[model samples]
Target: MAIIAGSTITASQYIACSEKRDKYGHITSRISGASAKAGHMMRDNVFQTPTHTKEYDAVIIGGGVAGLAAARMLHHRGMNNYRLLELESHTGGNASFGSNKYSAFPLGAHYLPIPNTDNQPLLDMLAEAGILTGYNSNGLPVYNETDLCYDPEERLYIHDRWQEGLIPQLGTTKTTQQELKRWLDEMQQLRAIRGTDGRYAFDIPIANSSVDPAFRELDNINMRTYLQQKGYQSEELYWYLDYCCRDDYGAGIDIISAWAGIHYFASRKGKAANADNSQMLTWPQGNGRLVQHLQQFSKEKTLQQTIVYKVTPQGNRVAIDYYDMRLHTTQRIIAKACILATPQFVTQRLIPGGTYDHDFVYSPWLVANITLDRVPESSGYQLCWDNVIYRGKSLGYVYAQQQQLTQVQPERQVVTYYLPLDHLDPVSSRKYAIALEPQQWVKLITDDLEKVHPGIHEVIRDVDITVWGHGMIRPHTGFITGAARAAAQSSPYKNIFYAHSDLSGVSIFEEAFYHGNKAANALADYCS
Candidate 1:
């Protein structure tokens, strides 16, 4: 089919074998094989007599941000004897990144918004990592200017021209403009609202949010329903909300909960000494830079490419059995306490007879990093850090080297594109995404970009596709305030705990960090 403009050539014809190289690729076949390996181990009751057994004060399963945070907390408490096992060769999980000869680019997560000033723990971590150099005399965070996103932060292609911001301005009706203003006013009021119990209506870390039924009731309905009830009928407004939801939650307003959708706007109340709340700290490798800071806590004792298939709680200790992909052998670890930093799906498999509620739905996603000879030419405004196409199928692309300070720019640049596969259900989306090849992904991405940058295929140097089968947890109706989440956070065994962004029903960096610290503190107290 003819996907590009002004040309009768098919998408396949545009992408030749010599023009594309699939580097830093992650196919879902490996995930399927890993699942099969775990299933077989459970079905056959094969423990595979461990090659060696080691004991630790605590053992963490999954070396993602949550696991890394847990490790850091344990280290802070002076508990040195711990181990972290990760299924992937790298430890960043969804925040992973890859590098080419020209520049480094994000594979999944990319930016972190400026955090609320009240979040002391997060601020302290950032301070330790040197992102937050120190506090000013007014007690506000003084972030490193270099790490903050540079000018020309965001732009949107609308009405055949690029605008200075992502919001719909050109071609928008007067009614749409009024509705947008009303929506912004409502969100600002919501940001200042406090529950009777003295907590913000919507707060980061999610656990700190007010629990009043007034605000919590929003979780019972989808964001689309809430918007309709509020008398918002602007097509442009709906599209913007849908884009925001998909960018953060991997779902649209129709699928995500009203509370989650609102949180995306109201929860960010960060006050900074230099940068504004809307400003974000980013790097060429995206959040992978933050991951590197967290990885230091577990680097010495982490076992990458090791999958923990089973976790059995004995009378006093937990027995963990894992397969080391590199060594090609099974091993056992006995720990006084354990933290399962894995997602609910993997957690269910690790602990036999443990079944998660059906509300826990994960969305599949596709992320591609395309390298080009130079930035693609666009009309209206110049290329920004974030370039969005209004009413496009994807979340647009981010200029990977936007944070660079060098006077002379590199001839080659990489732009990372994100697409949440929300058209079908999660199961169907995963099946569809895994079946696609690199060339298919390249076509899908280039076709989307062709709307703004005509003949964009000519400057392309390479395309890398990473498919996340269970990308992020979807905050569907009632899932955020449901009993399932509360139950999942608590452990039946004294020495076992849980930590992951999935527990929060909205996957983000701050929530993952919060849960990790929460689980680590609980485990440390029990061990003490």
Candidate 2:
């Protein structure tokens, strides 16, 4: 059967491929080999340098959002004798993006939720970046309308038709509808409910969330167990919550903690004069735009393609040894204070035999940018910024050009698709993801899109896929409440600061920014 513009495909006819080739034959992106290159680092041996050495006030590892944020904070505090190192050629890390003749598309992370008023640091950053317009008489922040996600924010493909929102309510029973409403209402109520200690049920940075035993107990069980205990048997509710779990934490509800699942809903307490928590801030390049803004203060201070292999504490100072890929030489850098902004897995490798030997697990993900010569028509709803296929393993796709204010939309557009490879273990996920040649990845995504847009594969001009072996930190049971996570944040030695989203047991922009600034402040006092 030939593919049609608005044709419907039954489950039997839905062709899924582990391997697919781009019918139009387009080139893969520059960042396509990132995962492979990074995979070989541990196995590759580098000669240590004895003669080459440099000193700075501070030296930071990892040029991701956390490192950049820490570097920016140090710069803002008049600390110019500092340097940040990134293993990759770019600074944004997972928030990095790439552009083509079509549009600038994300390689990994995308939108950001509006910050809550209490999140002063984030709000201050937004204000400085001109994203937050100003405060009203109520003191609520007024976000820039241009920065807010445009109308027609999200759409869902369910039962062969597209709906206005991501939730699958079409063809649902009364019980299903009631369960959906009940869950959402309960989440809204819980958002306002505080722990016994006067902390919100959930909060950004996660560290601010209540440590009350009543709430912390939720961290000991998986989300599925919590739902079962609550007597919620609705598959609809389960699918929605599970989708949310995978979307945010990159893991399924069965593996994610109850606290984390709820945090996914209640944690977003963003109240704006112009927008709500549901409203997001996005751009053509995804969160990379925000990363670009954060880099304004630290780009010149950052050295890319330089990997810090080891970090040890010395007399009142810290020592760092790194290998520069471009220079093909090893060098040593010593600083009065040091911030290890790398992930826990990497941190463990650099400085082994630490008390904080936490069992941190990461979820892998696949991000592909599919360029189209001309847009395709959907059966029920028009394409929106975020689009989801109900109950699919994939988180679906985002329109790269959706955030643009072009009166005349271009014929060419790029759709960035996200697929969290969490169905298997990390090792297996990496294996499966790496096994997929470009063609197989094309089939995997286009096949899923074809279920909603019949001929989405035909309009494709190009496809570029990225495999993140350790995409993001998973908030598993015991990760938040257990002492292991906190221990991971401890620095037994002086003048060495620990900073990374993993220290918070979650990987997000806000957490990274929070820990970065917090470490910078700590390092400032220590250095002084």
lDDT tens per residue, model 2, 1-528: 212112332333434322233342453432273546653664264556645899999998888888888988998888889999888888887888888876898888898898877999999999988899899999999988888999889998888888898877888899988888888998999889898899987889798998888888999999999999988988878998999999888898999999999998888888899887689988888889889898888878889888677787888878888888898888899889888887777777677454335468888888888888765887788989999988886888999998778788787889998988877677777776666567656655777788777777777877877778888898999888777787777677778887888888888889998999999989988877
TM-score of predicted structure 1: 0.93
For model 2 the TM-score comes to: 0.93
Quote each prediction's TM-score: 0.93, 0.93
Q: Candidate 1 residues 1-528, lDDT tens each? A: 432111233546546632653422221112111233443454455657678899999999988789999999999988889999888788888888888887888888999999999988999999999999998999999999998999999999998999998889888999999999999999999999998879999999899999999999999999999999999999999999999999999889988999999999999999899998789999999999889999999899999877677899988999999888788899999999899998887787788578867779998888888888787777799989999989887899999988888878887888988888887788877766766566556666776778888877777777877888888899988998998888898777889999999999988999999989999999999999
Worst 10 residues of 2 by lDDT: 1-10
lDDT against the true structure, per candidate, is: 0.85, 0.81
* Overall local distance difference test of candidate 2: 0.81
Q: Please report the candidate that would top TM-score against the real structure.
A: 2
- Scored against the true structure, residue 39 in model 1 reaches a CA lDDT of 36
lDDT of 1 at 372: 84
Q: 524, model 1: CA deviation in Å?
A: 1.3
